[model samples]
Target: MSVDIHFNASALGSIQEVSLVLFKSWSEKKTLPMKLTKQGWKVSLSLPAGEYKYAFIVNGGIRLNDPEANAYAPDDDEKIWSVLLINAKGQRLHSNQSYRVHLHDYSLATRFDGPGLPGVHKQINLAIDESIVSRFEFTQVEGLHTVTLAWYTPDARLLQWSDHYLVENETSAPIELMFRCQPKTLMQSPLLGIWSLKMFIDGAFVLEDDFKVVDEEVYSRRDFLGCGAD
Candidate 1:
């Protein structure tokens, strides 16, 4: 099913051009030039059911994110854009651990001791994140499960980690996998902005999430934040 997606541009007035860039498309044609309308700058795309990484190319040089997009993701150049999650029936999804195939529960947070350990997924501390984990629990599925976690830096570098598990619906129980990141290298001052994580089960797209990389203290007065979930 193909859904009609309407992208209302941010009020970046008096710009020369506004083009919509959709990454991870099924076809080679990804970028779509938007048109101005009475409702301001807008673009409409007939997209299939899947997750799309997108951003707005304003004036052909400046890359801007759809402020009102479902979510935001950073590209290879550390340029922050937007994310569009489409379900099978052409509905927009927020990735709040909704009805996903073969997935039971998914949670993301930073390892900072506070009133709420690893507070929210919005802002992450760069200094004191000695232990950060991405946990996922899968429903009972028989056979060998190979899960791969791909991490992307703000500037679009890669750090990948994988885990293998055996499970049976009748005989074996399941344990949530903790994909830990190199805190000293990952959460630091130099690497600050948006970082993304992709989970692939048996070479199939299972789920994806993004987080902002910031420089702040575990219990400090101010907050140095990155990009994602905003």
Candidate 2:
């Protein structure tokens, strides 16, 4: 269904453009330009029945998580943002786990979406949840090695991977790469199936995760047919 999302930035009278960057799960990222209204800077979108996280991009430079948003999540860098739940039924999606580090007194953990939409860009993402916020610090450190993110199909067919290599030590540094690909390139792959993501450190394997690529099933299902029980 469609919802009217409002943001109050009238205090910044000189501000001109305000864009809404909505991310359903971590995969689907849409940038909608908001119009200044008497109520506030607002925009309407027809989102499926599910949870979403959104932030207001002011002047295409500053990214402000909704201060008014009650539900929230943190990025890889521990920056908390506003999150919204559409048709939630107390169903938790991902499993959380913790790991101990040997040298840096650091522990690593990761969370990901259970399933995603058709577009590849919106299909898979790497994120850290709230449980490990206090323990993991993503501060940059030297002696980091090369990092790469790769995507693969369920049957182990490689679809597309990140060409840009990040030179940082995975063990000493923090994992902050959000793997995204071109919409057209991802669309060429199977629309409905399982996909996987593999992280490589200096050409050696690190960790792997998987997510489902469901079509309209995400919307057709009962969980998404309506908002939470009322």
Best by lDDT: 1
Q: Which regions in candidate 1 have their CA more than 4 angstroms from the true location?
A: 1-101, 112-120, 169-174, 186-190, 218-230
Models 1 onward score TM values of 0.45, 0.37
Q: For each predicted model, how many residue pairs clash, with residues at least 3 apart or on different chains?
A: 1, 5
Candidate 2 per-residue lDDT over residues 1-230, each given as its tens digit: 66778877433224678898888756667889999888878898777667777777656654555544544565565444556666554332332332222212222223334322122233432221121110112335442233445556666655565422333365644544444533234545354467666654333354565565543322346776576868
Question: What lDDT does each candidate get?
Answer: 0.59, 0.50
How displaced is residue 212 in candidate 1, in Å? Answer: 0.7
For 3-84, candidate 1 gives per-residue lDDT tens digits of 3344453322246677877866436538887877777567767777777877656567545444355554454654444578
Name the regions of candidate 2 deviating beyond 4 angstroms.
88-230
